[model samples]
Target: MKPFNTGHEELVHDVAYDFYGRRIATCSSDTTVKVFDRNDSTGEWDLSDSWKAHDASIIKVCWANPEFGKVLATCSHDSTIKVWEENIREKQNSGKRWKRVATITDHKGPIYDLAFSPSHCGLKLASISTDGQFKIHEALDPNAIGSWTNIFETNTLSSAPSRQLQSSFCLSWGKSRFSKEYVVACALEQSYIYQRQENGKYTQTGQLPAHGSIIRDISWAPSIGRGYQLIATACKDGFVRIFKIEEPVTEGGNLQVSLINQFDDHKGDVWRVSWNLTGTILSSAGDDGRVRLWKSTYNKEFQCVGIVSAEQKHDAIED
Candidate 1:
């Protein structure tokens, strides 16, 4: 990937690709969202569009649906999550572009992360905030306007004393191939997964000590006829551990989870770990500003396939 700078005076916190992967979206501390397009023939990236998006640093962004290439979502330290949709062709010709479609303000503190469920209905959204709360929302009417409804809220304050001290930070969702429901994983003091029940409520399915320090990111593996697949979580302690949930049928009919593997390579905090579309390869980025691509094979260890640096240059400014 080529580095396409926007000439902004701040650092970019998050970036993503549109549905077609032809266009890229990035949010920065400068409170602007920029879009770039990849030139097919030349294999070079070019800046196409940009806009002032938030009042503070945009922390994260995710595509609602890449197929339509219509909508995108972003979260910020401004304590809001905003959705933006592209305008029609005619409007774009007249200098009109993407506009804010929705702004969710239920968060009391800065929103750190967000995820759109892969179920395709855009009915469910999961968000986590610095206030140590993870919220789950559902659409009141699937096809109606302003259909979102808050259904579940988990807070460190209301949880047990042991959990109350654990701070909630990262959030992720996994679609169950066995069912239409999606599972939400929140990384915090302890890592846990909540599965959607048939009755429409989310229930805790598994819990584990994610890391020595705060868990930065957690991803669940896709099911391939196995009970429930594994989850990989990154930690500030510089370790990545993989855990698998075991639902072996006991005489009493019970389910259990087991720890599979843990790998320690980085000396600093591991900030993020993402699985590819196929779920076979994993990518991790951290405080060291180095991205490492890992593959699952031979041993339980991760083999770095690629690395990207975010190093800064120290030099005198030109007038």
Candidate 2:
């Protein structure tokens, strides 16, 4: 792996690659956001731009589709989310830069995650905060140059009163064009799935008891004409859990869900889980500082197929 130096004085919280995977954006605890562009010929990454993007520590960054131009969104501990757009100059020598287009201020606490919807969904995004709020925003115009209005918000405070101290952490939008718009959010001790209604409002469709502790991350697999939906969640309980949502035959029917698999091999707090583009392989990382990959066999049983550890060997260094 080629290391690219990000001159932030604090820890980098998150990094996101553009839809084309040619550029990357990173947010840091130093309240700055930096963008890097890959050199197509040299295969090296060069710092393209850096700026102070937030008033507090920036937690997450997400890129919009290339069809929408070079746009990005960032959330921070300041309890605010901002959308930025890049102005590309035609002249090769002219400099390109990003400017703040819109700022959303509704969440009462730190925003942990932000995700842009699939290109087919138009210009929409979702964010979850530590105040137990899940919110959705939609761009007024297709080009995303207009204002973004908050279309929906759900409060999960009443769902787990016993774990009030541990608020919502992560969320992911379902990437299935075959189904209606859906988003899954993981809070303190539970996960909730919301679906858009015919009236253009979002309502909670289902709830999954995801973990005993804080649910750190949630990822909805991309469904390519799949009959069902799959969601992967990582939790402080040291386990990664997968849930399946079955499609309903009739309109307005409740979604059916089942726990398909759970793995505790992380041995510590699991932080993130992601699925392959085809939704066939799964990967996870945890406090153990190791990345593990899981795959399914013919019997539909999920097992750990590979691992990359962070441990160092003193004997090998001495030799």
lDDT of all predictions: 0.69, 0.84
TM-score of each: 0.82, 0.91
lDDT by residue for model 1 (1-319), tens? 4566665679988788765678878889999887777888988777666788889999887776554346677899999988777765533223247778678889988887887777553556788888667887765654442446788877743432343564547776764556435454554657666666667776676566545787878777665554566677888788877776665354322236667766666668887787776677777777766777677677645566666665635322121
| RMSD, every candidate, angstroms | 5.5, 3.6
Candidate number of the best TM-score: 2
Report how far off residue 70 is in candidate 2 (Å): 0.6
Question: For residues 81-171, what per-residue lDDT tens digits would candidate 2 score against the true structure?
Answer: 9999887753222233778899999888788889998888878989988767889999969675558888999886564334435454788
Q: How many Å off is the CA of 220 in candidate 2?
A: 0.1
